[model samples]
Target: MGERISNSRVVISGMGVVAPNGIGLSDFEKALRNGISGIEFIPRLAALNFGCQVGGIPPITQEHIDACFSPLQLRNFNSDGIIYGMIAAHEAWRNAGLEPEAESLDPDTGVIFGTGTSGIEKLNESIKLVDAQKVRRLGSNVVIQTMASGVSAFIAGHIAAGNQVSTNSSACTTGTEALLMGYRHIKAGYAKRMLVGATCEHGPYLWGGFDAMRVTNYRHNDKPEQASRPLSETAGGLVPGAGAGAFVLESLEAALERGAPIIAEVLGGQINSGGQRGGGTLTAPNPEAVKSCIKDSLVMSGIEGAQIDLINGHLTATVKDPDEVAAWAAALGRDKSNFPYLQATKSLVGHCLSGSGAVELVATTLQLQRGFVHPSINSEDLHPQIAKWVPREKIPQQAIDVQLDRAIKASFGFGDVNACVVLRRYNS
Candidate 1:
């Protein structure tokens, strides 16, 4: 992992997003550029007496569902994560111009989809049914639907993948880690293309714990759009979100051979956990681990930190936002003036838990390809600690045109785990 493999550059050939802000690359890009707010008040949360009554959920319609699934596949499908993952995976496959229903399994292709808590809603329902002595009513697909590998399994079956289809869960770091793992497979010459992404099940069963833990914003229940204020001095807490993001990644050689549109090159990345040491816990990140993750990511990517044109932070609009900024400042060895443009995509889309990294990765790739930085909405008032570490002007509140030659996306999860990825524009 120290040296880059010759001719092993991984590039993003296609992307699909089922996010709170939008679905599909085109719509998601539009939402990002326009600074759209996807967080909304959920009456159910309010009715349930939740501390935070607002959240970000993708607005998937019946038509959208019909477009993604067949009549047979739709039957007995109780997993929201699976539904989201399928739509996103299919979108990425089609966007990459690859036919989903191949004649046979492409032995050199596979999937590495991830999820945080798989099908908790379905499991919750099943538990109640069994408690009521109605276990026989549970469908045959319940096991598959509620399993941790369900999303990846479904994607693999639908795409006819043959090489190493697997699911990975690392709290919130699942998505970025999955992408990097898929890239490693392609880089190692074990695969030609890897479908990589993550999804989180939508609903109270999945979100109630965070709400009970008082980690979500309750003040903005009356104003959902402004509730998730990442990097802002007035930021309260994270606004829980659910969705999926997918990408088709292949080696530059393979993408070129297939005449695929190169979106962004995956330079390299790092994945590690804090072991719950040095102020780290199940609920907070260790500053040292966060810093090391970034430093080693740069080393693996073979790029200087100064070369980072943009960063989509893991800032989740909580008290920890300042600590994240501080870690970034320390990791890059860049003071205020020399720092790169930093913004919180969570400011607009909220935190998608396990799906955040992949969704934000798609946004990061879009910025690289489109040569623009999406606005960091609801961060007009930067936290004093962050402003001390970064220049105010470096944070863009409106879409700005810039050559994003190199960018880094990082996700720090609940278990004090961290993952980072470096991406660069496809020059060739």
Candidate 2:
């Protein structure tokens, strides 16, 4: 179409999820529609333990993970990053109907991953071994595996991506940021395609940091699944969750040339910052900044706000963030009556930090493909101040009668850095 030529568009050909709800995209969608929760309690952390539970993917045994890594490049992998990345990458590749080797696809395709806090548990364990006993007890590879970009680098090498490949450590916005970078690379003619997204494990140190912020919900010790009620009147705080979400992004031209089935187009994306020490706290998001980013995304995508039928929100059940987003929606003249049908994925998978946006993107892609918008469960009521802008009830599970032509996924991180991506249905 004429519109396709004016824009250098990229499409999401495949997606993968390794979250508490399930290990693959199919299982993830099923669980999301059913409103399943994967949160549970953990007794062991530091003394700051609130006994409040979290959404955690049960630990994968080393042997089980190693089987996927294989012998050739196993030594190069940092356990924390590469193990989950390989699993997700394989799932995505298979989901897209691509061979593990990338056959007809260009060797110059890139790879990018987002990671917030990497290998915190392994670092803590290494420190303990060094302090109590001896350095020999601590593994030699501990340092490499604990670094934030180790996983991204390991995946790039594993996949043999011949062009530019990198990682994003942009806190909560990392996954969206990674996707943006991939989209840009393909759009700018830098590469034909890229693998993008993020993965993280539930580590004690991350929870400890949250505890110090006095923001984590310590009151819900008995009910883990019901704890992360974003936008709910009873919602207390956003809990830390661990998981990986990834997507394969390719240029439309490249995909059709290779006979790849396109899922949805990556219409456009934008990122913005909220500036320095926001009133002494670094994590608060600014409403104006969030609005600006959304505006930019809309402009770049060449789409009207009315065309956005769904919004995958970054509805962290935090005190200030959700209200900020609500204010932005309100300022845009979107309220209960005219708001985009919204769903917060964290209510099901928990907040995966850097991995949250990508995981939610996979959910949205499935939504568009199947024409069904999943509900934001455990959030039956909204905070009085922001209730007018949020969808507080269960969304119907039936497939939408019309085509899902467009949607948006919003992600905001500490320091008010935000990223929004516009996704559109592809007409093959």
Candidate 3:
């Protein structure tokens, strides 16, 4: 908390995203700008009798596969997580002007990609084959595709990452936590560039648990676009989603040396857990820990609560949304109109589960870089508690230009864990 602003600053040089609303950076940005909803009704989920049949899933094309994977790699490829991860990671790498081919592994470069549950779809496939006594027919790629570290391993090998190439899984916080972790790596001079992101698989097997738990929105099955209603009074439940988002985090000095476009500067961040105590449960966050996490993040960033201009929150369109806003207000020591402009990207993208933080962070970075705040659709009739803490106009249903010089992004996941990062416009 002392002289943190003078510490080694980390900056995002390149970004790539595979979202249900959009496929690439350009498409994603456009979708965000225009308030496009990616949540749709899946016929399979309905056929499977899932209570929540609508969800957000990216429309991946074969050309995208050909660009990211080789013919041999795709022969037995059954993991959609791998497909989304590679596409997003490769885009981030190339966006930073790095080529995929490397004559030798670079110790200064590595990856910290993450996923919550890997290859659930592939695991289901393997289970069926084994149950039918056709285990021999199971493809050799099954193991690699379903493993937790599969996404990181594939990208590390492709990029020739000689430094620490690894994976992290933290439920919904996987992505944002990875971003903070990678930033720490660069700050500690462990690596010059770390490609960090998170991907989540979709379909019946992955989302069935939530459906069974009755934590997903089933009321909007017919009106998919309106299903995910973060910060709204009528939010039934979260609409599960799947996608990937990635960024190339480079040391500020290294980015300047290489003339990489700095999208935003990571001032500092913090990751902590509430220990599932004091009203916190296996599925809910402890309010005390949530406040501390945000305060600590601000201290680490050497900034005051009042300096923050925007917030990209982990509002999953559940009963937790109001509680989350209360935590932010309490942590920042701000009330009502004094609070910074708040937004919920999940209103359009739905809750991406483990990938939610990363995709939302991408949206946050783009919002700052583009000098406009994307609309938080489906937020009409802000929940009474939330409205009491913030102005209604702050949560617009349409995009607007604003001087978003400083921002904070936070993600809270199951296990009562929280990760908060401070980002600001990289003004040289």
- Per-model TM values vs. the true structure: 0.97, 0.89, 0.97
- For model 1, how does the per-residue alpha-carbon lDDT over 258-301 read when each residue is reduced to its tens digit? 89989889999999999899999999998999999999999999
Q: Compared with the true structure, what per-residue lDDT tens digits does model 3 show for residues 261-349?
A: 89999999899999999888889999999999999999999999999999899888889899999999999888886888899999989
Best by lDDT: 3
Error of 2 at 76 (Å): 12
Against the reference, the lDDT scores of all candidates come to 0.90, 0.74, 0.91
Candidate 3 C-alpha error for residue 200, in Å: 0.5
RMSD of each: 2.4, 3.8, 2.7
Candidate 2: tens digits of C-alpha lDDT, residues 155-216: 67556677776778888888898999889877877777788998877766666677677777
lDDT score of residue 308 within candidate 3:
92
Q: Give Cα distance to truth, residue 365, candidate 3, Å.
A: 0.3
lDDT of 3: 0.91
Q: Give every collision pair in model 3.
A: none
Better of 1 and 2 by lDDT: 1
> Which is the better candidate, 1 or 2, if ranked by TM-score?
1
For residue 253, give model 2's deviation from the true position in Å: 0.8
Model 2 Cα shift for residue 226 (angstroms): 0.8
